[model samples]
Structures are given as C-alpha cells and as structure tokens.
Target: MNATAKQPISMNISALPGATTREMLADQPMRMTISKLNFWYGPKQTLFDVTLGFAANHITAMIGPSGCGKSTLLRTLNRMYEAVSNARLEGEIQLDGQSILTQDVTQLRRRVGMVFQRPNPFPKSIFDNVAYGPRINGHNQPLAEVVESSLRRAALWEEVKDQLHKSAYELSGGQQQRLCIARALAVEPEVLLLDEPCSALDPISTAKIEELLVQLKELCTIVTVTHNMQQAARVSDFTAFLLTGVMVEYNPTPQLFTTPSDPRTEAYITGRFG
Candidate 1:
C-alpha cells in the first residue's frame, strides 16, 4: 500500500511515545525482515525455516512453481494463515525490526496490507470500496480527500474520477484490481504484499498494474509473489526462487537471472524445470 502525498516525519514513533522498544522497532519505520520462518496447514508443512529480508522502498519478487509456498509465505507475512482452521506458523517476521507473529494480528494487518490474484471488490460503489479500509479502521478524514488520494495512488483515479458512485463491479477486470489496490492503500500500510496480483488480468491490465507497482514501491516496501519470470525481472530489484517450499536462491534481479549460483535457480529461470 502507498502513502498519500508524503506523510510527515513528525508522525513517527516520537509522537507515539515509548514506541522505542524492540517490539516497536520490529514494526518498521522502513523494511520487513523474516528469519527462520516456517508454516504448515495441519500436519502438512508448506514452508521451511526461511530467512529473507525485503528492503524498504523496493520490490522483492517471490517466484516458484505452483504450490511451492510462494503464496503461503505471502500470507504468513500478514498472518492471513492464522484464519485457516488448522494453519500454524513458526519463526518470526520482523517489520522494520518488530516480530509480527508475536504481536496483535489486528495491529499487524494495519501495517501490512495485501492484494490478491483476483479482484474481489466489495459489492459497493467505487468510492465505498476505496473508503472501506479507512472506515473499518476508524479513519475520520474528509471522505472525499481520502477516496481521491487512495485512488490516485492506485493509478485508478483518472478512470474512476467520474464514476465514484458507480458499483465496483461495473469496472473492468484491470480497473477492479486497481480498485482493490486502492482499498488496501486507504489504510497506509508500511508494507504491501501482492500475491500474483496480475495473474487474472489481461496484458494491458498487467502492464498497468506493473507500472503501479513501480510507483507504489516509492512509498512502501513491496513483496510480490509471481509466476511470471519476465515480471520478476522487470519489476523487482531482488528476486527469491523457491522450490518445494524451500528458498533456493535470493539475489539482485539481474544477478539472479543472469548468474544464479544455485543450479535450481538457473534451471528454473532458464526454462529448464521449476
């Protein structure tokens, strides 16, 4: 999720007071760091003790074959895994510097927002869809400004500027996905997690979202899960290749694609095997 304009540095923890502790530091004024992380759905493990760090103001793409746990790892970043009936997680995900797994999940969700593969806009007007997160989070700003700002950040403002009251479903697939991004941006999360967000869109729509991702990275740390190899190369500064729920390699995008040290990463990127 992207920030509006540029938030004042004064709003930092200095104003919140006593947020100087290690727990508060984990909340991240900047980046997200995951260490020795693992996850499982019931008795079946989906993630290994993965360790990775997503730099602030950059996009890190997670790439792998289906069920390699890319999406599962994305969910764990924000504790979406906790909602499932038998899901469990081990290890820590530190945002900025704080361990989110041990913190209040409700609070964690506010700091980490996610956009899914498919556009799942609410059955509401376009304006309301963008306004939903703020409304739910008890934001009392002037509704018009918040809606406009969020939509602009999502790169959907020009298209929907005239149809704020139209039902969200009225928008095309790409527009709907952008609306979802706007909805997530409404809450001003410190980190934005996208799970194959362009998979359901057309090429044109995918291009638009990719452009939006580049812009959004300027305002928040971004972690995206994608099956598109070109996209990983095009949009990400760093890329991590996973296989069977294990991280094979992680490095700068150029290096990872052109000179991967791990044979598995090279094979996957070169269209050999996933």
Candidate 2:
C-alpha cells in the first residue's frame, strides 16, 4: 500500500538468536506469557515492568497513543528489539512456559510471526513470497503443499490461486497485505503479532483483514497493536491500553471499551485525547 513496491525481505540475524531452535519450536505448546518485562533503547526506557497473560487461541489488541510504547512492547515479545544495537531488556517473556529469552531467537520468531503496518510482500512471485519463510527455515516438504496450505490459512488462496506465479507487485494493495499475512502463516506460527496491520488499507480491505483475524484466532494466538478503537473493538477479545510507556488498563474488549475502570482509558476512548 505504500508508494514503494514490496521488496525482498532481508535476513535479520539479530532477531534470530535466543529463539527456540528449529526442532524445539516446532513442538512448542499453545500458551504464551509475558512477565515483569522492561525494555529500553540505550537511555530511553519504553516499557515499564509490565506483566500480562494472553490466552491461547485468542485475539488481544494493544491500543495507545503514537508514542505509548505499544509497538515497542509488541516487538519485544518476539525479540524484534534485538535488531537494535543498543536496545536493552529485563524480565521474562515466555512461549508455552518456556522462557523465550533463553530459547533460540530464530526459532521463537519462526513460531511467532509478525505483520507490519504496511502491506509488504516480497518482490518475487506470489508463490515464492508465501514460501520464503518455510524455505529459509529448511522445510523439506513439497513446495506446492506448503504454498497452498499457507495461502488457504491466510484467506488469500482463492484470490491468488490462479496467479500464483505472478510477481506480488501485480496484486491489489489489499491482496498484497493478505499475501504478507500468508507469508507469515506459511511457517505455522503459534502466535501472530500484527502492528497496525490495517493502517494502510482502505475501508473494504480493512474489513477483510478483520474478518481474517477472527478466523486466524481459531488456530493461533493473535496480539495486535492498533490506534483504531473501532478496529480493536471489532476484532479483539481483549484490549490493553498503554500511555507514556505504562499499561494503564487491560480488560476484555467489551469491558475495556464500554466500561473501562481507569479514567484515563475512558477519556482516551471517549476521544478526549490519545
């Protein structure tokens, strides 16, 4: 959706270590937990000692102002902060009761996929775009099966089924976003993290992604960061509100939106201020 066409993803070696190993991650259980977590970039602390739990097979949305650290916290969950040279973290983040900080980072990411704000498909053919993750992780299965199943899971198979070999650039912006989702799903991640996934799409495309998210929660835990209250209310089972790098409130989506306990949350949701 951005002006630039999708570019081939570059390998992020820094985010690869401390993750579960290839073999171990494939066998991980369903639970994912975050405990007493704190994060900082050099001297700038972003997250406080935040502790929270996400249920298996549910959708959790993180909402807050632009600089409230929602995205920072999401990146920390999957060790995306590792990519930054001066980033520092304290406390434990676990997937299935296993501390992710102690696991092989690459494996952790493979088990936990992320979709960014913009639709960023690879420059390659559509099939290759979805297949990239599995190929990089050394999946030996037949390529056709991998691509088809992944596309189906991402809810993009039918739309792109006939154009599998075409360059991802040719697809509509919405299709490219779904293709990105398919690329993440290809590896069969246990948890999917979406950061403002619908920010770049039009209203119709945004609705499609929301519908797909509901379907995705049946298979994996989903944690999304969004600035849109309507989108969070529409898709998430739970919602967490952050401000100035602190979690002000976290509750079931219905309660958070309709009867938030914190006055700040109420004001933010009521359009007083972000």
Candidate 3:
C-alpha cells in the first residue's frame, strides 16, 4: 500500500530454531513469516517473542485457551492492532519476502484479508456485499463476474445465485459467514486470516466452512485461530499451540496432535488443562 521504495526482506525460517522446520514446511514456500514478535496493549504485553512461518497454500491453525493471544498474534499479520489505542508491536512480519510493517495499512489489508468470528455481512444486497472490496480497490474486472467467482469459491454461489439482489441479512447464519468470506476473497488476497470463523455456526455450517477452507488453499494461504481442537485437526496442515502469550509448540498438525514435543501442548490438547 505504501508507495515508498524499500528493500525486500529475506526470511530464513530454518535459521530461526524452533520457528519452523524443513520437514514441517516440506516443499511449500513461506507465505508469511513472523520473527521474534512482541506486542502490548499499553503496558500490558499480550504476545512475547513469538516466531512462526505460515506455509504457502496451506492452512495454519493457531490454537490456545481464551486470552492466550491467539487472536492477538493473528491480528499482527495484517497490523490490525493499529486501531487499538496504545497498542504496540515490535518485530518483523514479512509477506512474500516484503515487510508488511512498512506497507500502507489500507494496501496491506487488501493483500492480507481477514474474516472475524461471527458472520458480518453488510446491510446491502448479497451481490453488493461481494462486490464491495473490488469496487473500493478499483478493480478493472466486471463486477458480476467477480461477485460470482468469489461466491463460488466460498461455496455459496449456487444457493444465492437467485437472490443476488436480496439483503444479506435475509441469509442464514452460515450463509452470511460464507458471504463475508466471499467479500474477503473478492480482493484476491495472498493471505487470508480468520479469527474463529466457524465458532458461531452450527455443525452443518461449520462443515461447509471447513470444506471451503481446504478448497481455498489452492488460491491463498490461510491462518486461522480456532478454539475447537477437532476443527484445527480437520482443517489445518500445521498447528501452533499458544499458552499465555508464548508459543508452546508448532509442527505439522498430525505430529503436534498425536505426539507434541512440549508438555504444555500435550496437556492442553489432551484436555488435562486449558
């Protein structure tokens, strides 16, 4: 977003011990990398020396107890914390080898889109909701095509195809959430951040969202914060467990869930304690 000239930042995840492993990343490139990130709200710190890498075209799940800074860490990727008074961050966050901190907030958000926990559709027509981002970003593509493509990707096009002109509020809870996802995708972001996206949905709705996420990995990288361990296991390729602002364990989802290296991770995942 910032038009200022700057140097590209190279991220060597392998050099940062415990940040990520070659086995965990496999052949996937790093889509976004956070190194030694620290954040605070005024004087109260929320995240401490957190380092992780989100693999390209993969779903990385952040799982932890309430107030453990899962959402706090996710917000840092797109610098969403800037809106909070007295919030501060210290670290380097790179998106495709570029520092997002130096980019314009508006443009950074466009490249790194987000969807909140609850379904938040606009007070406009279904078509208008999906078209909003592109229209604001001055996209040259035809609005109808973009809307259709986004909705299809979110897996809501067929159901809403006949109701494009209807108000978004008229849709079901799950449908509205998918619509929000469609709105985010309309901008064609490289990284999609979701904060407990399916937490408020029913089982069926949650399943749809999960399926959509898997399909979406082909288009963009996904980082999600979820309290549902089953959801994390079902959807994510990599999982990071956080406890009281510290990242306890980060590894491939299968390995982390089955044989976590850290005691805290095992305890939390096994329901011994949150």
Candidate 4:
C-alpha cells in the first residue's frame, strides 16, 4: 500500500534571474536542502558532513572525480540509498520543507524520480516504457497523453512519434537515454535527480539532453551529478564541487568555474588535480 502523503506543497527559494553568489544563498528559496549529511556503507564512510541548498526551479550540478561521494549524496536526496543493505546515512534532506528521511518511501519516489548514469530503457515498446511509471503510480491523466507529453518534454517525440509501438531497444543509444528520461517524466515528479545522464551519449545527443534539462527546470527542480565540467557550465545555474567525501565549495556555475572562492575548487577545476 502506498503511504499517504499530504497535498504537494510548493517551495519558495530566493533567486535572482541570473545571480549566483554565496551571499545570495540566505535569500534563496530552495526545492531541496541538505545539512550536516554523512553516509556510510556499513563501517566505510563515503560522505562527510556536507551541507548545501538547491534553488527551486534550477539545475544544480554536482561535479567531482570518481568516488568523490557525488553520486552517494545525490541518491540520498530521494532516499535511494535505503535499498542497499547496510547503507546508512545521517543527515537531514528536506523536500519543500519536509524531511525526506521521514517521508513515505513510495510517495517520495513518486515525487522525486531518477535517471541513471547509463540509459537503461526497459525491453518494452517505446510507448510502454514511457507509460510504465505513470501506470504504477496510478496517475490520473490519460496514459497515451502522458506518454506523448513525456516524450516531447525529453525532446524525443518528433523522432519516435511514428514508432511508438516499436521495441525501445531498436532505437539508437541516444533515443534510449531520452526514453529513460521520458519514463521518469511520466510520473510528474517534482524533482529530478540525474547522475551522469550524458556520459555515454554522442555529442549531438548530449547537447539535446542538456537543452532538455534546461527547459525542464522551468517546471521541476533538477540535481544532476556530472563529471563533465563543460556540460555543467553549459546547463547548470548552480554548481557544487565535492572532494574526498566533503563539499569543497558551492557556488553558481559561472562563479565556481570562473572565479572559485576556494583554492581546492580551483585546483580541481583547473586540472591541477582530480
């Protein structure tokens, strides 16, 4: 049985049209906020005390080298870590002012959807793949309409409109990735978490996905973990740098990439060290 969730609430994050600064953080309204977060895989800690705020209706990118705890931190936002045995976290992750740790897992999953590092489309028809999540969540909208809307939002409807009944695998790798995104969007999630969504796609596909992500923030908050600094700069409004399980710096994408306040952030961004 799905646990009962209160009516969906809206958040109020303070943000300027194009401003990204630490001093502005205090006034920013947030879609999700993390404070004093730590995570462990049994006795092995992967994240230290990390704190940050994700502005509502914005794309915040988490950039770091491999094993830097970026993925672990992203998973915690939706409580995805709970599925792993002995994986534990100590922290407060709030969605629209509600603590996600205390949220009903099913309801939270519905509101906060995820796209994996690789495109993992189901071995189903294109239409079926996009319709799956809405069906599982008992979305009231017409199923066909939901599928079309999701595909369009992912910027894939035009390419596959005539082949909705075809197998998802028959599409190119980029289409499969967009299909996965369409699947996630069908559920009408309020926040979307993406981890290296474009790492495997071609440059053209990567650009399309980046464009889609930028458009998506107008309707939902996005938190993505990417190793591509250029992608981060191209698509994100805010960027947070992580290092060895701790937050090195959190700033607007431009500030972090152009004039990082911390030397560690500069070193990593400049290729001095990973």
Cα lDDT tens digits for candidate 1, 1-274 = 1232111111222233342232332343448877777788899888776777787888989999998899999999999988899998888788868888789888899999999999999999999998888887888788889999999999999999998999999999999999999999999998999999999999999999999999998778899999999999999987888887777776668877887767778889888875
The per-model lDDT (C-alpha) reads: 0.84, 0.83, 0.90, 0.86
Global local distance difference test of model 1:
0.84
- Tens digits of per-residue lDDT for model 4 on 1-274? 0121111111222432345375565466888899888789999888777888888889999999998899999999888898899998887889999998887899999999999998999989999999999888897889999999999999999999999999999999888999999999999899999989999999999998999999999879999999999999999988988877877778878888998877778889999887
Q: How many steric clashes between backbone atoms does each model show?
A: 4, 10, 1, 4
TM-score of decoy 1: 0.88
Give the alpha carbon lDDT tens digit for every residue of 5-43 in model 2. Answer: 112111121232242332222233337777677788999
Clashes of 1: 4
Task: Provide the lowest-lDDT 10-residue window in model 2.
Answer: 1-10
Q: What TM-score do all the candidates reach, one by one?
A: 0.88, 0.88, 0.93, 0.91
The positional error of residue 255 in candidate 3, measured at the CA in angstroms, is: 0.2
Ordered from best to worst TM-score, the candidate numbers read 3, 4, 1, 2
lDDT winner between candidates 1 and 3: 3
| Predicted structure 4: lDDT | 0.86
lDDT: worst 10-residue window of model 1: 4-13
